[model samples]
Target chain A: MTSPTPAILPERGLADRLTALFWRHPRLLLAVLLTPPLLWLGVVYLGSLFALLLQSFYSIDEFSGVVKEEFTLKTYAELFRAQNLDIIIRTLVMSAAVTIGCALIAFPIAYYAARFARGKWKAVFYLGVMLPLWSSYLVKVYAWKLILAKEGIITWAAEGVGLSMILNAILAIPGIGGNSLSTSPLGTFIVFVYVWLPYMILPMQAALERVPTSMLEASADLGASRAQTFRTVILPLAMPGVIAGSIFTFSLTMGDYIIPQIVGTSARFIGLAVYQLQGTAGNIPLAAAFAVVPIVIMLIYLTIAKRKGAFDAL
Target chain B: MTAAVEFLRVSRHFGPASAPVKAVDGVDLTIAEGSFFAMLGPSGSGKTTCLRLISGFEKPTSGTIRIFGQDVGDIPPNRRNVNTVFQDYALFPHMNVRDNVGYGLMVKGVDRRTRDARAEEMLALVKLEGYGDRKPAQLSGGQRQRVALARALVNEPKVLLLDEPLGALDLKLREAMQDELKALQSRLGITFVFVTHDQGEALSMADSLAVFNEGRIAQIGTPAEVYARPRTRFVADFVGSSNVLPPEVTRAFGGPMKWASLRPEMLRVTAADGVALAGTVTGIRYLGAGSRLSVALNGTEVAALLPAGQPVPEPGATVGLAFDPAALHVMEGEG
Candidate 1:
């Protein structure tokens, strides 16, 4: 003991230190790091889904006006009923038409912004396009409703400008017009597309902007013309963005209840049908079953989108 | 051969007239066919702008650019019979090597078989034959550079514009590639109008060179002509390291004499005294193959390069430096 005792170093092994760290304040660390997200995913998302799924399995007795917990395939069976299937098909067609229309319109605007527009003007132009997004979604949809109505400003202005006859002729085209602008399925489809067009354009503009200007110059230097550069260089690079925008338009059109509720009269979409089932008829199970249809369609869309590198764009 | 590229009194003014920045001001150049011509300058010296004007990327505000005797003022970059290898290489990242090389052929509506064969031939010429399927990201920087070369050369333009092609490579690789590029240009027999800020690159690879200063071509001559007898102080200072001593002409030295410029390598260090300036060695840098001495003579610094194993004077030691009168270049004051 008198011969100068050798100092011993403390052995703090990795596992031992980690164990001690966790043991000190296990609940506190868990709450700090994991509780907020766990509560959000577990309670908000999963709790609602658990109730909805439970409702999907139950049967509602129309005569007794009482809900029964007896699980059956009848609600799912009713989802494929002819009238319901028609609504599903109509929603898909409307979403496809809107996506195509948006892509055609947004491509040139995005290309011009990314390639030609310089300085503050590019930011101003992009901000102008995105300015519509900040406005209330309901107000925009309602504004469109007034514009397209028979006695609204657009029709009155068309008549005042002596373009009423031309407007009527254009509206009466086969598959597009049945009778008049306000009371047709095409009218509702147009309204839906107008409301959701911004969602498609923003993502597309972002994707197209990622293509370096040097790549385009390289293409031109290689003797490609303007049209050829667009086809070969511009289109392929913007594919991932286009697919992403399409997914947004498709899923939103499928799930949206308000737009179709306001504009649709003759042509009923699955979203409107689901709303009627849940709210008007009190057929929660049938509505839940119909909800599963759009989810399935969305899943298929997401799968294809993932395969085409759409997820990477996001 | 006739001039493959010519810019006559070309001036390009950007922005408003009141305070216009003349990127290239009144430049007149004629690049001989099949010659490796280098335009050397620092950043914003208008060398690149001149190249862009010739390549039809930018139009001259007041003058004309002709490619192979035809006016290219109204023509676009793709329409001009000249291709540019941009400083960044500008290879299409989405495309494979073969597609990138054959882009010009494909755009011209050549048959796929012929285009593919031509692409392969170009790839082989660049020694990148097996890298056809690989993207630009997969290749190393040097390999990517070669791919860029193959892509530009495959187009077979009347003139190829290289904007600092070797500026991105490491020192050793750049030197090797410089030799390769010189050999390639000769083999292809295509006129190359290269732009670079590197004096060594210009001197090593160029058949003739133009030194640009403040939006003007200060001097243009062959590498030897320019180096041996620089007309302007800017040219002498830019092209090589020089000890510009303020020496008054004690005697009339007739042939185009102005201020004296003595290149560091031209100054020989010797112990023998007569007909030489005496200076104290302020510093000595023993650079393995050779030694560089910083000598102070009359409060002015003069650098002298001496071969290794030659006795180098220590700091504060007196040394005699001598150079041939022919080696002392007379140059005009800086423009």
Candidate 2:
């Protein structure tokens, strides 16, 4: 081709050359940009997870206090032992309770923020939801530990309100009670729900915000009362958000060790069991197996949510 | 018979109490039973607000609203015997078509079998007989509109409110739905309050219509009366493309020195042969059926519609405009 009068082009520095290269082969540019994060996720995250899974398939030598390099179901069989099984069931029950509690507490706050609060009030809502997350998680757990103590403000307030008898009656209940609120399963549950509430509220608020105002009006126009409209329209439409929020609350509760260790009676949850088994007891295989339980439970939960059409809204 | 819905000087206001935005102001209207009534106006002109007031979605800031002779100002939408087909056709995404249509019945504690049968019947009425298994997401825009109609009609409400139900459809589908809706309204013999900004749809479908402007009813009459003898400059300007002539221009055209409306279709163009209303042709737009000629007369522009194959004047040519005296309808009162 014959050249025309030459037009001046910008000096092809590294940035200019890179831009030209990117324009020529977009896939190559994408690969170059994605390499760092992809390597981090693949090598660091999944690599450690693969190691854990491999360890769960191995057994520890009983007499030598050493991990055997042979793959066997002996470690898996240890999960069915009476003490380990008890810990699993207790943790499952606590996780389910905490998830349900978080959902109930988060829904009204989320709904108010989504549908009613505007401008400054919406800013306040977001600040209130996110403020706790910015504070130290251990600090909040410890604060709860104090508030729920035997001689804390709650007990003093109960006494001031002449409700000590009622409080005593509640503390007399079996299985959930200990010497006081701070050492009870109920206390642990309260802390779990409080800690995870922001997770549930944000996703639920996002879901609720997506629901059109016209839909509610249409339901009411069709002769459905407020309650009916809420049940038939609002709840169903917000299910995907609920499921999304529940994934966080449920999994977080299932794997939390701090709250149970610090607040509740010495009843070992799955997380505490995993912690103690790996560290104090040096039973790494059983700890790995215990860690796998929450992952398996989450997979089952997600599958059920998918089959129920929860993610369709998302 | 009592009016199906009556508004006694109703007004709805929003925003600050110090200086509120009057969405609907001092409006008195009556929708007759068994009539297809249209509320016609541009957006934010209070037509949709009026529909909401009747459906109890919005309460009047002042004045009384009556349904079938009873004052229903305090009543909620669920207690009112009316249903709305939303502009977006807000069908429930999770439910199948049958369940969505049957939701009202289900809320009323009707058995599944009977509500299902009624829903199916309603679906068939809207010509959607066997599409009950699909979710709303699976349906096209037109199909979703049909489902919304069926869902509202399944309740057999005394009053049916449609808020720009056909606004989202294509031209052909909108025309077909217009005919179908008109047929359904007459066959059912129930009051239907439809809201739209489209003048052609209002003229073709409504038994009677109220023309709204600036949060007030400019005029309310049969479609022909509203289209032909509009009571104000606003109505004449909004309802159809009419040349709104000022008092001086009206007098120049031999009118009684009053504000008047001259429809383009009523004006004729001819050579400037010593005609009184002579003007220079500024532009000619070729419409499919006819051509529109814009003529500048005494520095004011007036439009004339000439039928196809009629001789068209070139731009900048002087042309005479002629129209019958009766065609210049005099409007009453300020807009």
In terms of TM-score, the best-performing candidate is 2
For model 1, the superposed segments whose C-alpha errors exceed 4 Å read A1-77, A178-194, A264-266, A302-314, B246-257, B270-276, B280-288, B311-318, B332-334
**lDDT per residue (tens digit) for residues B120-146 in model 2:** 999999999999999999999999999
Candidate 2 chain A minimal-lDDT segment of 10 residues: A2-11
Q: Considering only the true interface residues, what is the Cα RMSD of candidate 1 after superposition?
A: 2.4
Relative to the true structure, candidate 1 reaches a TM of 0.87
Query: Compared with the true structure, what per-residue lDDT tens digits does model 2 show for residues A146-242?
Result: 9999998888899999998887778788888778888998889889999999999999999999999999998898888889998889998999889
The residue pairs in collision within model 2 are: none
Candidate 2: DockQ? 0.74
Indicate the worst ten consecutive residues by lDDT in candidate 1 chain A.
Answer: A305-314
List model 1 lDDT by residue over B1-335, tens digit each. 79998889999999999999999899999999999999999999999988888776678899888888998888888888788888889887778899889999999999989999999999999899889999888899999999999999888998999998888999999999999989999999999999999998999999999999989999999999888888777787888877665544312222243566778898888773774477899998888999889988767888899988887777889888877778777676565
At residue B234, candidate 1 shows an lDDT of 78
Q: State which docking tier applies to candidate 1.
A: acceptable
**Please, what are the lDDT tens digits per residue for candidate 1 over residues A1-314?**
46565476555799777767878978876777898999999999999988888888787897985678898887787777898888888888887787787778777877777777889988887787878789888998788777778887878999999999988887778766645565666677777667677777777778888887777877888888999998888887887778877878888888887877766465677788788889988888888887877778878977886786544323
